[model samples]
Target: MSKMTGAQAVLECLKREGVDVVFGLPGGVLLPLYDAIYQSDIRHILVRHEQGAAHMADGYARATGKVGVCIATSGPGATNLVTGIANAYMDSVPMVAITGQVNTWLIGKDAFQEADITGITLPITKHNYLLRSATDITRVFREAFYIASTGRPGPVLIDLPRDVTVDEVEFSWPEVELSGYHPSVKPHEMQIKKAARALMDSSRPVIYVGGGVRYAGAHRELFELATKINAPVTTTLMGIGCFPEDHPLSLGMLGMHGTKYANYAIQESDLIVAIGARFDDRVTGKISSFAPRAKIVHIDVDPAEVGKNVRVDIPVVGDAKNALHGLLKEVSPKARSEWNEKTETWKKDYPLRYIPDMNVIKPQFVIEKLCEIAPDAIITTEVGQNQMWAAQFFVHKDPSKFISSGGLGTMGYGFPAAIGAKMGRPECDVIDVAGDGSFLMNSQELATAVVNDIPVKVAVLNNGCLGMVRQWQELFFEKRYSATILGRTSPDFVKLAEAYGAVGLRATKPSEVEPVIRAALATDRPVVMDFIVSPAEKVSPMVPAGATLSEILELEWCDVAQSCHLEKIYAEGRKEVLGQEEF
Candidate 1:
């Protein structure tokens, strides 16, 4: 058999795995791998920071439903990838992270740029390896990709020691084997029947979808099941695109800053058909009180998540697509005319609202306009008010369209993510709906986009503060603003974009909102459009921390309480739940 260096084998394995592009930064021990990359046909994106590389890879994977690859060196370079690795793990995005380690001989001697990346990322990765020899290189890479892209997809790390990378080994592809890593692709017949029975018996049922629906390519099955059951569907923040937002069955997003109708529906549900969703605390609110009366039918690929959060009456541990496909056959079409009418009334009564200001632009208005202009665009968001507004206003027509940092809630995720999305799908329009605070966290990526000629657009809702934190301070802390205000140190975004050799535009008035967004979209180069918005604007339909979904507060709800001088919002929520007038 022909022989090749471990670095060359890595390239060969990547090519075999269909990896055409990778996002990463170069460092000392990574030079050999970088050299291999340079000599190969594979394209490598040079990110400004190692964190951006990880997020970019994540974004690409989310957009394409494929395994994304990212590389970093040892020490700080490997450490910087930790947050992004965790972000992928939480969101169930498929990614393989490669880190160059110091020589195996110097591993414990604290050599220069040495780090135990495998150990560092143990909790955040589905699996990780510390290569001891060049002979293990091919097997390690094959296993990493296999583990990363299967089951409940997540990041996998392969730590390559410098000596192992340069050493010569046989060039044959190794067969991947893992005895304890079998993921069930089929749902249990008995459990699926039980879930179907639960759905048919309940008049007030709701389908709760999460990121797994998108990861498993189960959107079609989810839609079929929801329609067959005639159940109201409420998606988690990560599940935004799993169901079409404009569908009659859709309750939009639920929990925290979720829509009023969605939170109310969950509070009143008798049966919750949770498909591929881990009942996260953010979605559950107070765990004990959430969906208090509902009998849960949990379906997930990961067995550990079945009864880990809320208890489930029927648990089907299998791939979401397969489970949902089987469920569609076992369940008969259900009709809950009364339940539908009630949810419709709630949706009409408590619609998402923002006051129109002729003097200044509203963040929601900008998001709506972008949705109108780019209806088919792939949208990404940083964590905060901007994320909520985009989730509320921007209608995602299909899965793999709405990408955001949901589980990890990373602020700097959107910009670099948009770049990766653009690279993954050059035909589709990609946009990052960002907050001023979050945009600045990785604004350096604008250079990466411009340099690569990736034409992704960014809309920065410049409220001159960390809008979400300031909103909380406004509501809970008696408006005692602390470090949340960013106006004093906020950079001029238009100037910043221009310095990065990107197109820059600003919108100060409501009239300029549409024009600015259109102009940004028309540009063939990377563009950053800064929309100066009101500081007082808050994402409404909010459920207070540690409170039940019944305690959702909206603009009108907040106004009424403020006028009545009420000390607690729970009192108002109690009245509403009792069918009393809200105001």
Candidate 2:
């Protein structure tokens, strides 16, 4: 083993793990680490804020399927990374955030810039470390990456004190061996068979997919099982890209803002072959009424998540990939023609549509144009109405094509995430589908993109207010517009983009949406297209808060007949459409 400073050992360990890039900001405490970074071959993208650094890393991990890394200084710097860390954790994105602490001797004394980062990030991180000694640096770095990338991947943090970085130590990479950290990746034979039997027996089966399927990279297996069993597939928001939306069996998304037909299909199904999914509250509105008729067969890597939110008739605790493999072997091909016909009718009855008004731009129209023009772009979204619109309009034909903050629903996440995703896969085009309010939260990242020459395009849905909140208030609170509108105070997005040395374009009319999006996609320099969409436009196919799927609402603008809400099949269609097949 060769002797080196802890800072050098950090770089060496990263090299061993095949890490090529990192996103971070430097401070006084990180001097030694930054010095080592400067001398090393690893590419470091300097970020405007520690939060941007964390999000960029998260985006990088999601795009490349590798553990993304970021670094920051102590106190405020470490604290700035908290939201991003939590975003990654809630979404199960694999990341490792490194922060430099004050000298070890100054540890409980509350030295300047000192804060307990380990304590702050405990709940959000899969695991974290506070370096005890310089000698432990090698193992810490090694284990941090291992933990971050494996077993239902999530963020992990490493706190490096200044003294530890400067200390000299002999570095030797040790084999990772935790006493009780084995993740169940292989499913039990009996459990897989039982799940297979349940799935095969159900007449009306629906596959409910989650982000776990994306993490396990089991889309092929998932596809095979669904096709073999002749089941319709509905995905959660996080599960959007995992299943091909263009496929005949695909039922886009289901839940509060999901497609009406998907929600209908789920409610009518007799069996839910759930794969890598958690029954989040948003996906299961009014829990008692959710899938009231369906028995569940859950396959997941974490045992705790299997029955945490919903009851499971057949539970297979293992990685989604392995479990799917086992199910594929046990189950044979079968055609549920009656169930297929019902899904098609549901799809036709409640298609996602809107009035074609050339007067004002609609967010959904813009997203559809972007998808048509740049079908292969890796799309990331900032939270709000824009997030929902992207989820609804963009047809994700492949896995990893769409990224967003699903659980935490953090605003200001898309732009930086686009930057990180671009860095990880420079060959692919990256676009941030953002709402104006959410875009402004981290708008300063435009400078980061310009300086680094990262040409990540952004489509800003400029509704002139917090669109989602405004919709909620209008519907439920008598339109008492509080701190939502950024009317007169909103900055001119074109000027803002120009000031940051990036190209800016604006589309006010419906006719300009497609051309503007095409222009942004064509530009080599970073471009932000501000589509001045109508604030009056709202996301349809919504199941109101705490309401059952049977009570879904739609806007008259969506249908040619000016329909306000479509009656669910339970009342009039299911029995007639499916020849008396009852759930």
Error of 1 at 116 (Å): 1.5
What is the C-alpha lDDT profile of model 1 across 101-123, one tens digit per residue?
99899999989998778888889
Measured on C-alpha atoms, candidate 2 has an lDDT of: 0.89
Q: Per-residue CA lDDT of candidate 2, range 331-376, in tens? A: 9999768999999888999898776676767788998998999999
Q: What lDDT does the true structure give each of the candidates?
A: 0.88, 0.89
TM-score of candidate 1 to 2 decimals: 0.95
The deviation in Å at residue 250 for candidate 2 is: 0.4
TM-score to native of every candidate shown: 0.95, 0.95
Model 1: residues with Cα > 4 Å off, grouped in runs: 556-583
